[model samples]
Target: MVLLEHPLHGAGGREAGPAAAGPGARGRGLVPGLSLSRSLSQQQQPRLGRRDFRLVSSLATTRKTAGRGWSIRALGHLAGARPRVGPARAVPSCMLGCAAAAAGTSSPPRCRSRALFRLTAVSDPECSGFWLKQSAYREQPTVRFRYEVLFVATLGPGPGSLLAWSTFPAFNRLQEDRLRVPLLSTREEDKNQDGKMDLLHFKLELPLQPTEHVVGVQLILLFSYHLYRMSTFVMQSMAFLQFFSPVPESQLSMNGDLKLNQRQLLHHCGLDTRYNVSVVNGTSPFASDYDLTNIIAAYWDRNVTTVFSDPNPLWMTGRATDAPFIINATIRYPVEVILYPLKTA
Candidate 1:
């Protein structure tokens, strides 16, 4: 735990002194009375005014300053210069009446607090061929707060199908392994009571592959989708896209320098052939696209003099005619892909 010196440490360190007497000091341990004791030199006394006296009095009543040595130097600093002596008075009856009035005992019942439900979708509506509209609350006060909700979806059966899913990376890096999505909450509802509304909500989306059997699409519901909470603060939400695909049996050969035909080269490198090639595109269209052409070329030129150096070069044929070769071709597409930003109240 972090610790710091108390603001009143010096005051509490002073010594205690005998109680002073007279009109300026009266009524030992009584309300509206002055009890002055000095344990320190004048330089160590805490100079206080009338306002400070009232504040100190309130502090004394609240038991915040007791036992902690605090010195009062003079009563002349108080306003009105009134005598300190006073009767041992009971708390005012009117003050007690005021407290009772403010107790809220007779107020009419009302919804004192509100519970909120929010729905957020992250998708490329144009590519996904669907726009999402939440049946839940329309909007919420854009506050920074964390919450959990369920996520559910229904999939149409097909040979090669794509579905929207969400995952959190173990860390911020994209390549890190993902942990299973957490479950938040569950509920059962039957508005019609005919079993038509029966559904199970999930807190996370599960990626499901295509199946042979035909199944009619139905509503998928998620419950308790967890989200970071913020209150008037900016935060970032990172989620992973879950995908399902058939795995290939054989690994592709990365034996030697690869040489691709012009069309294959351009497509693989994500370059528009119509555009002029420049340093921005790198030495080769595909190679430049990934900022890897120079490095791959240098490595290939240095180590392997013939296209037949390895069992199977990526793009180069084993024939001597194809000597100069390319290895890994990486490309960047220009199109921007935007996913919906999830938001909650």
Candidate 2:
């Protein structure tokens, strides 16, 4: 889940314009090679089932708006088959009015025509679960089962997107396990008003295969921030795991009753070229158990020398167009003042 990025490329975007004006953005637009990094932290974020804000096509306006916003169509190779997408959709500016009215503001912000709605992601979208139904039950003699947990993501109103994620719960005949969630890429964001990117569009992978006739299971999702960690564990997936048994040890006893242990190792090879190559093999890492963690860690870790090549040369880019004020244009500070500095006259 190492999403290499430029500072302005984060969902926080450039801190200057109204469209991307938030607390987190420090630079205006993309600062070439200005890298923003997210780390694995000990502190955890809480995840329930439903903490998302859904975006609906505002019915107030007669003009069509539903099929205009962005939606995720491809979830990479790990998400199994791409879910059938219905239509492109977006929420309108009137959302501000409704939000204000609920807040007891004397007068709500008036809706505008040209540009509105800041695209946001919604978690646990029923459609994701429905796709699993099609994959699991619809196909007779189905061996593969897949489920998805959606999260509210913010596609930059002007630029950038922060992709947070949801959970995948799997159950079968009293057997259970968590599937691996792979993030091919991340769209960093600043969801909190604290002024930094705290959100991301983390495309995850949860694919499974059942060995028997499928029995329906209620999928429950909890929100989590650690994609790299949880995906590595891959605990409790019952659909594909018919049964799990631990390996037993045959001990060779020494004179003092001490035991010596030995195990077999598998050999492997992978894509060698750095980023210039088309595919970064084993780009996504997952751990099924402690041993798997070591294997995966060794695989993805640079300098392992056992499999992967050295770390790829980092590359970052920012959009050429500067994000402009789309919300309250009048309140915007001058671009020169925000992005440029003054010297003694």
Candidate 3:
């Protein structure tokens, strides 16, 4: 068990000074109201080359003011975390509300809280393929002020929009990770003592893979405040295409009126699977954007293989490749992919 008198230490902010002790040694006791305490424990056996780690924790704090006592306890495990080594130690960025996503062969767990974010969109008849009309979130003006996002490689296809989500890297080399995003503004905030997180707005841009028509992309967001981190996997999508050979236009922009499955859309977003949402069936090229229409028709109207989105993007039941977010198409064709930025309502 890891114990610290200061909440900052919960995420390994300060090195283990002489005050550090093991489980049976001592656990930090709570103060009436003037101080902060946090406890984080790792349950997994140590592994050699690993960044992802699981933790089991039971946390509670008590304080008194004006002769009135108040306390809160958060038991059970927080979300799973990926670690980052700081100046002196290997620390797990405290993930408060994180959701599992599909990566390579493994499917990590996923979740939602006042601080968590979920995805939702529907097919459009008048625009490009689709538009995200809503994002699932709640408003909370509580919890202490906390937060960087670090970009690792361009996860295939190539350059696209960057996202800042639930948990971010606690300690990142600012020099190495560019894209200095300005302080973000959200519609809701967590300012009071409430443990709930406020709703936040998010935007995502997907990069395109050269020569490939029907591939998928993943969007992972990191949000770090003080010592707390929140990472949410927003999307793992199999996109339909509208190629721009000579005049490359926006990819997956909501300007096109395309339609897709609701459940698949929700699944790609790491949402609950029981949702009944619309899936992409076929294309009705917009009157404008003839170039885009022709491109979509060429592939969607052709003999291209039609695939479907997985009911859920979880590792066990879903594939990282495609179909976890799709449905049978109107015609077999390559779906041009585009990325959409999601906003809070």
Q: Which has the greatest lDDT?
A: 3
lDDT of 1 by residue, 1-345 (tens): 111111111234321212211232221221122223232123223534344444334323432222111111111222223222222333211111111112223221111111111112223222221223221211111111123221212233343332221221211122223212332433333444543222222222232223311121111121111111221212111111122213211111232211111111111112222321121221322423222244335333321111212323122223222121111211111111112223434
Sort the predicted structures by lDDT, highest score first. Answer: 3, 1, 2
Whole-structure CA lDDT of model 3: 0.24
lDDT of 3 by residue, 66-107 (tens): 111111122222234433222232222221111111112112
Model 2, 201-221: lDDT tens digits are 322222222211111111111
TM-score list, all predictions: 0.17, 0.14, 0.16
Off by over 4 Å in 3: 1-145, 152-185, 189-198, 204-345
- Superposed by TM-score, candidate 3 places the C-alpha of residue 121 at a distance from the truth, in angstroms, of 52
In TM-score terms, candidate 2 sits at 0.14
Best first by TM-score, ranked: 1, 3, 2
